[model samples]
Target: MISEKNKSNRAKQQTNHTAGRTSFVRLRQIRSESDEHLIDFFKEVRWSKKKGKFVTPATEEKHNEMVAKYSKLEPEKQTKDVVASIFREVLGHRPGYARGLGEMVIPESSRQNTVEKFAALTERAERHEKDAEYYKNQLEELGGNVEKVLAKQAEYDKLLSSYMESQRQTQGESHRETQGPA
Candidate 1:
């Protein structure tokens, strides 16, 4: 029931769409290539034909966490590949979507490594805050006088150095001390 002119126009449109679009890679291909640990990730993404959307069972916090973790994975891990595929699968090759997905996933490092580094950094920051609080309390206790605080600090440093000096006896001094009044 279509005219040749309309059919030609449709073909032209299809060609244009196909030219610009990168369809989602099939899941079978992804499964074969993906690591065993990512099986949980696979289970998280599902398509809903009736709703025409993905049925991710993640709460907002969980989804954001997953995005963060996935972003930090190496480019070679097929993480982005899986993300792109799922993205296109759910959203389709949307018209004019050529931004390259560059900053969407910020790569910090491998997840375990990044997490450990983050933990260490966080612990350091907490320790620094505690030290700052202690120093602030000490300064306040010095009656808000900068000179007094500096003097106290200098006194503490002198005392600490004196203790250190006593602990480190020269060989000659030790020998003289042991020989005593000879």
Candidate 2:
């Protein structure tokens, strides 16, 4: 049988260990909360878990091309929504786990607050319709410029054809006149 004194000493040791773990956890939580890169770290890890979703050089190039091609589009494309969507798709339906350090449960109020904030963002996006229309008009003007260039080219083609035909006729008439009424 273990002696009472030894048992008490073990209990004391366990208590110290528990206190150490508790303080460590609190410090970690504070660090995570205050670290600006925490969200970025989470996002990077989550998306990188998917093979092709992570940004590669080729993907970056393609994104740049798309951005350039659609430069006139209103409401700049933000990767935040895409990254958040990835997280939701991956984790939103997963079972809740709050047992240990790894398990995290977002409070219902916090979730509701996030939803409200996103709702406001959606409203702001809706309000940007006029700006989007303006961009569409700019795109239409570029198309119109292309059409004008095509029309001008066609007009020049017709003028050249007429001028060539007139020249040919004048040369023939001059040759015939020089032949002295052949």
Candidate 3:
């Protein structure tokens, strides 16, 4: 009972809806790629999905206001050192702190110290490994010796039992002769 014209219009609408969804997905992909670049640029910052914003120390203005407030305090209460301390407390430390502390220093001594410590640790590990292998070999040798001793003891037990049986038979015969045919 559907009209031919209405059916063609519905088909056209479905095609448009699908195309719209495809375009929206592509847009999202492009946005996400840009977001990745932004995240890389702001290493110490994080994206807050709940607030829909980025949180970073560099982007904050509160620190400047706080510094000004602290600077205006009574001379006894606030000094240059006090302001610097407040700034340090507010900013804590950034990822570039170490790099900024020594701009281009190679820190060769520390690197050499670390390498020496690592080499010492590796050598100790190898020594312990060798000791473990030696102990394992010694254990195996002890086990083999124990097995040999047990086998020899079993043979000795068999021989002793045979000798005791022969002695008992000889003793029985002698007792019978001495008793005169019991």
Pick by TM-score: 1 or 2, better one: 2
lDDT of 3 by residue, 1-182 (tens): 46988888665531111122334334334555553321122222333445655343333343344446665789798654565455445435433342211223222246788899999999999999999999999999999999999999999999999999999999999999999964
Q: Pick the candidate with the highest TM-score.
A: 3
Candidate 1, pairs of clashing residues: none
Clashing pairs in 2: none
- In candidate 1, what are the lDDT values of residues 45-111, reduced to their tens digit? 3334455544443323334544566566677865656765544443335443412221233333477
Please give the lDDT score for candidate 3.
Answer: 0.54
Better of 2 and 3 by lDDT: 3
lDDT for each of the candidates? 0.52, 0.53, 0.54
TM-score, one value per model: 0.23, 0.35, 0.40
Give per-residue CA lDDT, model 2, range 1-182, as digits (tens): 56988897665521121123344335446656553232243323323343545334433343344344334445555354443343344323345532122235443356788899999999999879878999999999999999999999999999999999999999999999999974
Superposed by TM-score, candidate 2 places the C-alpha of residue 145 at a distance from the truth, in angstroms, of 3.3
- Backbone clashes, each candidate: 0, 0, 0
Q: Rank the candidates by TM-score, best first.
A: 3, 2, 1
